[model samples]
Every structure is written in C-alpha cells, then in structure tokens.
Target: MEGMDKEPWFFKDLSRLDAIRMLLAPGNTKGSFLIRESESNKGSYTLSVRDLDNNAGDTVKHYKIRNMDKGGFYITARIAFNSLSELVKHYSREADGLCTTLIKPCQTRIPQKPWWQDEWEIPRESLKLERRLGGGAVWRGIYNNHTKVAIKNLKVGTMSTSAFLAEANLMKNLQHPRLVRLYAVVTQEPIYIVTEFMANGSLVDFLKTNERRQHDHKHPHRHGISGKAQTLWLREWRLLKRGITSTGTCGRPTSWCLRTSSARSPTSASLASSRTTSTRREKVLNSPIKWTAPEAINYGTFSIKSDVWSFGILLTETVTYGRIPYPGMTNPEVIQNLERGYRMPRPDDCPEELYSIMNLCWQEAPEKRPTFEYLRSVLEDFFTAQKQQYQTQPC
Candidate 1:
C-alpha cells in the first residue's frame, strides 16, 4: 500500500469478498497489502497496493479500479509490479474490457452451410448466344462476385458445346497441386463453372508485368535472374505443365509427321502473289498454324500430343518472360517450319536440363514424348538440387 495514492474499496456480497480473499491470500503472504477506499466515498474506488494477485501463486501483481452504477459495473485491471521493474507495463481501459470479456468461455455455435447450398444460382439468360459480351466467337468475363471468378464462354456454334463440357469434365476429374480447383459445375441454365480465385492473377500476367517493369527501369537483360524470380518461373512452369499433361491421352496421330515433309512450301513469290489477290492475306498469314501440331494444322484433329506441343510453346513464353517463340515470323512461316521439322530455339539462358525436357516435349511423334508424371519427377529433382545449392551458399 506504500505505492497507493489513495485507499481502495468496493461494495460486494459476502460470497464475492470471500472469493477475492481466497484468490489474494497467497499475495498477502508475499508482502502484499491493499489501500481501501475512504468511508465517505460511494460506488467508486481504486485498488492500489505494494503487490496484489487476482489468483493464488501468480508472481504478477494486479492494480485495478471499479465503478458501480444502478444498471452495471465497469472494472479495469493491470499488472503493476514485477521484480524486474523494467518489465512492468500499463494497459488502456479498452484492453482491460477485452481481458474481462475473454475470462469467460464462449457458448455460441453456428453451423456452416455447404458451398453448393450457399452459392448463387446461374442465370439462364446470361448463357444465351445474344447475351455474349464480346463480338468474337469466344466470350470471356470475370464473375464479379465475392470471389471474383473468371468464366470463358465459347460460341456454342463455333465449337460444339461438347468442348466446354469436355473442359469442365476434365477440370472436375483432375487433381494436381498446381492445377486450379474446379469447385462446381452448374448446368441449370447457361453452364457455369466455378473455381477458386487466384489473387495474383495468371503466370502470363505476372510475366508481362515483370517485363514491363524491367523495361521501364532500363535494367540489364540479366536483371530478372534473382533467386525469387527463378523460383517463381520454375513453379509456374511446373504447375502449367502438370495441368496440361496430367491427362493420360496422347495428342495428334504420328502419321502427321509423315505428311509434314511434303506439305506445300510457301515461297516469297507465292506469298506476294497471295497478298495482291486477297484482302484476308494478313489474317491468313498470321494464323496460329505453326504453333499447332502438324496433324492439328493439316487434318483439323487434335489430341493430348498437340496439347503437349502447345505447352512447349507456353514454356518458352514463360522462360523468356512473354517473348513469342518465333518473333517476326508469320503464322504461315511457323507452320512451314513445323512441317520442315524445325523446333523453336531454346533461350540462351535456359538450363541444359530444361532444354532437354523441352526437346522431349516437342518431339514430332506423340508416343515419344515424356509423360507428365515423368516430367514432374524430373522437375522435382531439379528444384531439390537448386534448393540444396541455395542452402549451401553463404548469405
């Protein structure tokens, strides 16, 4: 009580006083004393002391004040003393209120509804052909809901509705650490495919942003080679590759390679002649033929093998930070090169092991391409090795 500015007191029933005495008895033995309120005071008091404990055997001494009104009472408490004086601290009235509230156990329980039951119903009119936003054959829009999900609506007539169903089915059946999760498929009206939102956007968006930042800063070509960038690119590529190749199906037929050697070659004269005759020359020339596998381009057929070839192009794009595989070449030229069995050149900075993997992925024969499982294992090993190297190096 030597530290008290004034005496402390509180009005309470006999039972409450007994409980407080029992709680503070241990502190009393350890040289604690209380300063009681002056007898003239009413419904107001401060409890200050040399030492006080809320509970027995606790080293911390609490200082507190209480005020009683007709309806309720307000109380505040703080640890006021410690052997290490430097460790003593104070708390605000709101903090003491929080401590008092937390002293009691919560009894409320609320059952959560299943996701399917709680999500919004898809509108049928939204799926109508005329309701499509973009003029192009494909409609792409973000479902601006709480989750901000993306939806791609391919023109029903351009590609059969089966294609959309196939994608949805594939998404549902697939399970990979890197693959985006398909939460639900609603076929009630316009088909709605629900998926988890990726807050950071796609790998494509990230690479584009990175490239823009690098150019804006006028940084050197090697500027983005930091460990963080490398790790991010590696992880993105691994996830993308896994998502595409997880299906056991092999793409385009092997026979496409046999015919590729003999496809009509486009000469400059032929290209020039076509340009003069056709208004669609540019569109014809800039088409995605080259990136398409020989079978897909020539026969209008595609399979998992063709998907692998596309994945290789995507991998190149990712590694080069959004650089097209063959810049300046027209679509026709790309197709011609593919027909001639010319693969895209690996980036100068690409690791040899990665280049080897790309070569396998870009194999002319679908059967010869490595499986996704095999690719995952190889990448895992590479990542593990890289991590070990990083750990061993001095910071």
Candidate 2:
C-alpha cells in the first residue's frame, strides 16, 4: 500500500498521447515547440512537432498514430526513425525569423576568479564542517589570505552534472547584496559551491530562534521588536523579494537568504529590474510536497507564476515565525483543497496588505497571480504606508 501510494497518479490516469497534446497546448507552448495534426492517406492521423528556437538549428518530426494499448499510443513505433532525435531531423526544414535572433546567447559570461595564485580550489584541511543546510552542507573555509567564506558541498548524485553547472552559472550572473555571494564553484569530486557565510544563519532559523528567545524573556514588551529591527526586516524582505525575480532564483524557500547586520541601499531593491529569461529550469521534482505548486503537482508544469505561489507560502512562514504553510494537512489533502480554491488563512497579526498579496498569489488561475515585479511595487507602497503610520502614531 505504501509503495502504491507513492506512485504518481499522472502515469496511472493520464495517457502518453494526451500528455503530448497537453504539452503542446497554447498555455504550455513557449514558442520553442509546436504540434500540427493532419489526416494521413492510410486513414491514420499524422502529428508533427516543429522544434526550433533552441541553440541547435531548426528541426521537425512527423509521426502517425497506429497502435494503441492499455498504456495509450505507441507514438515512436509508427515513425520512420528509431529514435525521437532522428525523427526530428527527418522532417526538419529551414526557416529564418526574428525569434532566431532573440534566442541567441549574448556573450560568454565571465565569472570572477579567485585572487590567490592557486585557482579556485579550497584546501580540504581548511574546511571546518558546521551543519547541514538543506540539500547541501555548509562549512567554514578560508581562502585568499584568511578571507572567511561558506563552502556549500552538494552531493554530485543529487542532480545531473549539467544542472550543477547551470546553477553555478545562474549564481554567477546573480549579483545582489541580499542574495548570497557566489565566490566560485569547485567541481572536483563532490561539488563545492562556495559563497559568503551568513554568520546569523538562514532567516528562517533566525526568526525561529528569535521567537523562542522572546517567549522566554522577563519582559515581553521590552523584548518586542525594536524600530531598527523592524526597518531592517522590511528592507531585507524587499531586497530578497526583488532579487528572486531579478535573478530568477525561484526554486526553493532556502534560495532566499540575508546577512545578519549588512544593509544595502533601498534603491538596489527595485523589482522593475529587467531580466533575460532563464534557459534553465529549477528542478523541483524532489522538493517537499508542501512547497510544490498545484500545477507542478498535477501536470508537471512550473513557471514564474508557480514561484509566486511558493513565495506566498514563504511569506506566511516568515510572518508566522517559521510555522509550516499547510499545518496538519497531508500532501493529497492540500492538493484536493487547492483544486477547490482553498487558500491558507493569514498568519496571526500579519499585515492586511501582505495578506492581500498572499490572496493574490493563491488565485486558482496562474494568469491571475501577480508577477514578482507587480508584487515589488505593491510591497514598496506597503512599506511606505507602514512607515507613515508609525510616524503618525502617538509614540
């Protein structure tokens, strides 16, 4: 029963043919792929996929649907070619378009090199293991003459080598104060993703620890959030929120981080910052079921809109002092409820404006959810209003 329950309902209930059609649907198509159907002389239907706009040249493939079994269509069987790649090449035709120009890579990204004479390699003896940080483990290490940095050692088997490189490449492009600083990627043996250490630990843990300390205080109000802390929290929140959209780091909740005392100019937190579309997709297949978006769970579709949903949950967790988003609900229960338009209630004392953002994020249709850019503007206004309200108070 346990084994059966873990099985993906997608394979059991949905057929391969139907899934293919769904993938080509208007909502799913991102101009990279297109499917066309026509009638064949032999009474079978012919379907062809036009795969273009990738780094590779244009290609198309045609196949006829003739055989059907309990598992649905045996699509590749009817094609002249043995492999999918071969089939694409058979029917491929030449084309020239504006999109082709747009799809080209701009320039080779140059990552910052280590100042030390010895490349980016970190001596194993220098690393002092601290503790686990989700999928990766962190360690304190020194390089370039006693410069302290955090070393994130991720298991190579966790993902494909290409994915590891993609992540490293993404981090190199993402330069922000609120986001962690990527020093260099050490690819020897187990992958070491080097970054600046946050001595204060993750914001999630920081908040949880603060909540516990406050509860144990002699004077509750005295230990209540100071103005400085409140301001810093809002500022950091804005930075992290903007950084997510700017750098396209919408993978997991842990992707967002903050330094304990470091503060950057508010001008750097503009959500309107333009970003090129990321070619790489943050693989969330193994992520916790709770944090997984509804669309991703049902159809294996993920996008920036889905990230907004996760962000809403993260916001809820932040305001509630690290409380789980759907507390007391199982994964199946959460999915069922979400499909029926169920949304989590606002955390206790959560600001009305922030809760409104949460409601927007939980909209049934992904299109209805506000973009991170939109959220950025709304948050700026929210913070402005908050500061004004505090000023007007009879303090």
Candidate 3:
C-alpha cells in the first residue's frame, strides 16, 4: 500500500492486536477503520474496523484483504477492485460486505451527513401526474409545472427507505450520458422518484414494436429466430454489446431496460458490479437461479468471475431478443445440466465470434472466465468491426 497510494495510516508493520486496540480506543465509532500490513503474512494486509453496534463480541473486528493471483484485490470473493484505493473507496461508500463501511481512517473524525439531503428532497405538491407511462410504478409527470419528468412511485411500507436509496454517494457520483438522470426524491406517504423523461418511451416497447413491424413485414432474416424473439438481430446485437457494460442498467438475469438512442461506452463488465459470496455450492438461496454461475450456485463462491458467467446469460438474453435463457429447460433441469458442464448453444444466426465470447463467459471455473475488462475490450473490437460493416445503429 505504501508503494501504491493513501498512506497516512498504512501501518506497514502494525500487528493484529495493535490494530484492534487502535480501533477500540476512546473516540472511535463503528466504521472507523484502518489497514495494516499483516504480521502473520509477509505482504498481505488486514482491515481493522470498530463495530460498537454488534452486541455479540468485542467492539473491534478484523478482515483480510487478499490479492488476486491474476490481478486486482478483494475483501470477499464477490467484489473486487483494481487497487487498494478503489477497495477502500468502495467499502467507504457501501458496506457491500464487512462488519461496516470504511468511514474514516482508524482515528480521523469526519462528520457524516444523512444519506438523503434536505435539498435533494422535493415537495409532493410540485409534481403533477399526467398519465401512466405503461405499467409498474412509473408515470409521465410535470415537475414544478414546467419540467416533464418520469415519476416512479414506491410504497414506503414495502421496503425500508435506507434499502432503496442508501447509495446517495453512488448516485451523486454517477454522471453518464447513457444513464437516466434522476432529478430529486419526494419523501411522503408514497415515495416518488423523479427522473428525466424519454420522449420515445421505454427501450423494450420501442424495440418490441420495431420487431413486430419487421415480423409483420416478413423480413427474410426472421426465419432464423423462433417464437417472439424480436429484440435483437446479429447486427443489432453487435451495436448494443458495448453499451451493455457501460450503463448501470440491469441485465436479463435481473431486469432489462429500454434505451433512448444515446448508447454508452465500453467498460468493465457491469460485471464490475455487485454480487454475493456463499458457501452452499449445490443450492442457491435467494438469487435469480437461472442467471447464476455454477460456482455460485453450488459453492456460494461469487466474484466478477461469477459475474462473467452471468454476463454470458445476459448476452444470450440480448441476442435472443429478450427470450428467457435455457428456452426449454426448467430451473432444476438447467442447474442439473450446468453441473454437467452444459452451456447454452449459439442462437440461430448468432455469429460464431459472439457465441465464442459467450463460451468464454460460461467457462465452468470462475477463475477461467474472461473478466469484464477483457470482455469489454474483446466486445469493442469484435462489435466495432461488425458495426462498421453495417454503418448504422439498431432500428
């Protein structure tokens, strides 16, 4: 860490007991944390944090920060970072794992602000509901009698307020052309989330409508695909592949969104994403089972590597035009086949390169799967060349 960055309290030689004592000292609170080189291991580091809220044990706790053999670092297998600074920054923002988030270095006192700021909270009276956007919780609305906005109303009792928008830090830091712009939050009996309105409607409807038109017209290429598989053609899949990783939008394993034409840049696998690590490999607990990787389902081991596996599913869903993955298979059957090294075959008319990429994503061993970074680069090269062949975005 000294050779890397942020060394005000790196403590290269600090012992485990010293770390616990420093974290438990007089003024420290939960989330007060420090990183010290491990005394037991030559080059490894340990994260020590105070957790006064835990009634089970002593106030201070320790976690190991391990280095990935290939590259990056991780506190848990589910999440990884390119550097120690990013690892620190991520946990500081959200305690995705760990006893608590890394608030300030072990001793530094920094005033914390409420996750929701008073300024970001808008009054309900200012919003005028126009019409339902389609279904679900969203609607077209007028904000302050002038601005047209997309409004999403959520029931307060259904989920905790902290659970929904706890990532104020993540939200504030997000600024991208491809992502929908959230305007403000209305905290009332029903929580209203206001965002920029897209005049064309959701991407799903747009794409579906176009697909229906193309199908009705009897486009020759339609013969290759089956059912209502209307979302993507090979050309269109090539166009959207890069945009897939750049946005925070959910993929097929979770939720997929509509696009507004402004696509995104290629980056790490949205696989540079959120995840869970578990020990029960044979059975999946709470996650969407179909999209999960074998390592995660059987052993509870999750990482960006597992995310790569999910990305393969995301890719299949994309190319198949929103078709459910493992088309004819049940969840039990899918899991059984996956355990036997079964990967979905290439979709009809799917390019070999695209399927090859999917195969890389589907590799059974978590460590063997291509990373989001690698996938981003490969997709960019492959799709860019294909896009140049057509010279147009998806219709």
Candidate 4:
C-alpha cells in the first residue's frame, strides 16, 4: 500500500480518439493520454504518455500509437474544425426571430395616478388665477431686449390698474438680491412679468414637500448625525434674520450685505439719504398693505415691524418642518388666538435654545421682538456653543 501510494500513475494504452471519448464522458476520470512522434525519433514513435488519475479509482484505459520511424501510420483528427460556428449561428437566429409582443400595453395609458394631483390641482388653479388677476404677471423693469413688458388681458379691473402701475414702478426701482429683479413691464394679453427665474422654486413649495416627506413611510425620521431637522430650523432662522437686517436687497443675505455696506459709506450716505426720502415719498403715494407692518394686522396696514412678526411665524414654520402653526385650527381660530396673544409651543424635540429665540420673536409687542441683527448674533452664539460641547464630549 505504501509503495502503491508512492507509484507514479500513467495511462497504459490510449488512442487519440479514445482519449477524446473518455474526456467527453459524463463521469470524471481525471484525463487520458496519447503517444505521438517527436523530432528525436526521426521516423520512430515516442511514448508520450500522461497520468489519467492520481487517486485510486475504476478508470477507463485508452490508447493510440503513431509511428515516426517510417511514418507508416499517421493519425491526425480534424478536431480543430469542430462545430463552434454552429452555436454562434444558432443563437443569432433565435435572438433575431424572437418576438416580444405585449398582450396588453401594461395599462400605462390608464392615466398615471398623480402623486399630488388630488390635493394640488385646485390650489394650483387658484394660484394661477391669483397670479393672473393680482398683477403678478405684469412686468416692471427693462428686459435684456430693452422692451417694456407686461402681461395683458389679466382679468382687468379686478386689481386697480393704478396699483399695478405702482407695483411696476416699485419693482423697477428695486435692485436687491433677496427681492426678485424686475427687467421690464409688458402689458400684452395675459400679462407677462419677466423676472429672474428662481431655479429652487418657492419657499412655499419647499415647505410643502418637506412636510409630505416627513410623514412618508419611504423616508422614516432619522435622528442625530448633524440633526438635519435642526439644521433646517437654523437655516430658516438665518434667512429670516438676513431678510430683517438688510433693506432694499429683497430677501437674500449676500445681496443685503453688499448693499448695506455700500449704503452706509460716507459717499453712499448722501445717496442713501436721497433714496430714503424718495422711499418715504413713495410710501405716502402708495400705501400698499401687501408688505404691511405688524400693527396693520389690526388696522389693515403693513410695516417693517409687522414684516418682522411674519418672519417669526415663518421661523416657527421652518422649525416644525412645515407643520401648521395651529394644527386642526382654522384661519379664523388662529387669528382669534393671535388677538388673544396666543402662540404655538415649539415641537417636543426642538432644541431649548431655539425655543427661547422663537418665544422672543413671538412677543406680544411687535417692537419688543428682537431685530434680525440681534437674532442672527444670538443664533451664531448658540450654534458655536453647541458645536463646542459636541466636540468636547467623548465618543
């Protein structure tokens, strides 16, 4: 047994055809071998054998001997010309002939159930109508083409044409990053107010989507890890603060910073004074309540102070990820509560620091509400402190 284990295994008599047959057999037999002519044999054949198996098994014996000594018997099978080309042809034909006719068109034409069609269509129609009649489509500034543009055929008389003219003038004079830039006013049919397009759409749209996604099962709430929910609140606070602190720059912070610095400069101070006087004159000429003050809420007047109050409400909205200030409460109810000096409490998981800031903004007296500049400073401090604490804590 020891000697057998040490013995080298070899095929005894294997013809090339027999070797090929054994190789193609279903049961594995390791392999078979063939004898062939070598150059050294001149015309004699050489015993070029190989092992069939190293393991102990019932193996098939096969052989072929070719003479080189006199070249009497030469065996060469045309194995190279096998039917490999036939397989390629077979598949090519099958693929080309295969038909994939649908029994039905997958009901694709059944009209896709719009994810938000039910809730949004009516509101969207209302918005379009409001935009049409409220002089929203009226252009107010020059366009690149230098043509005075305005949307025409707007349900005219619904909104005073004088008011539209005033808005157009206001828009023309306005050059701030936060405020939409007015190029030209065109009063063609349907009124086309050409302004810079906001790729990010509106704050209202973002708020709606955020609210929907929060409750979507596909996107469950995940906490911590920079706390994205809290981060959104912080962002809202910053935006509100920016909008409040700067004047004549719309609602963008960067634009406000640029314009504010220039306006405060000595040379710009004279220009600023003139602009201020002009603005006061315009206010007297056109007492629009669209941008009214907080006091106006009671008396139907809009002011910067009232705008700040609105900002506070907006901040609350952001913190809650678009949750209504008073869920299940009607607008009348909300207004009544406001009249009674009522404010919504912060969401349960809201940071305490944020809650405090919101409370300050909701002060009964509009004048008592912290200015945007003050709010920004407070938020900066709070954020810095929180970051420091996070860094100091052990993992």
The candidate scoring highest on lDDT is 3
Q: Residue 172 of model 2: what lDDT?
A: 48
Q: What is the lDDT of residue 54 in candidate 1?
A: 40
Query: Residue 122: error of model 2 in Å?
Result: 5.6
**lDDT (Cα atoms) of all candidates against the true structure:** 0.40, 0.46, 0.58, 0.36
How far is 34's C-alpha from truth in model 1 (Å)? Answer: 53
List TM-scores for all candidates, in order.
0.45, 0.52, 0.51, 0.40
Worst 10 residues of 2 by lDDT: 260-269
Per-residue lDDT for 1-395 in model 2, tens only?
12422322212232233333333322222223322233333323344333443322223334453434432333455334433233233433322221221111111122345422123334455455555544435677664545566776665454556555555654544333234556656665667767766554555565466544464242222211221232343443433322121112211122233332111111112212313212111222223446556765555555667767766766676566566668999766776787787888877777776788878877778899987667766666676676676667674
For candidate 1, list the clashing residue pairs, or say none.
7-36, 8-35, 8-36, 8-37, 9-37, 251-303, 251-304, 251-305
Report the error of model 3 at residue 103, Å. 41
Name the regions of candidate 1 deviating beyond 4 angstroms.
1-145, 154-156, 175-177, 211-287
Runs of candidate 2 with Cα error greater than 4 angstroms are 1-136, 211-286
Give the clash count for each candidate: 8, 0, 7, 36
> Against the true structure, candidate 3 has what lDDT?
0.58
In model 1, where is the ten-residue run with the lowest total lDDT? 253-262
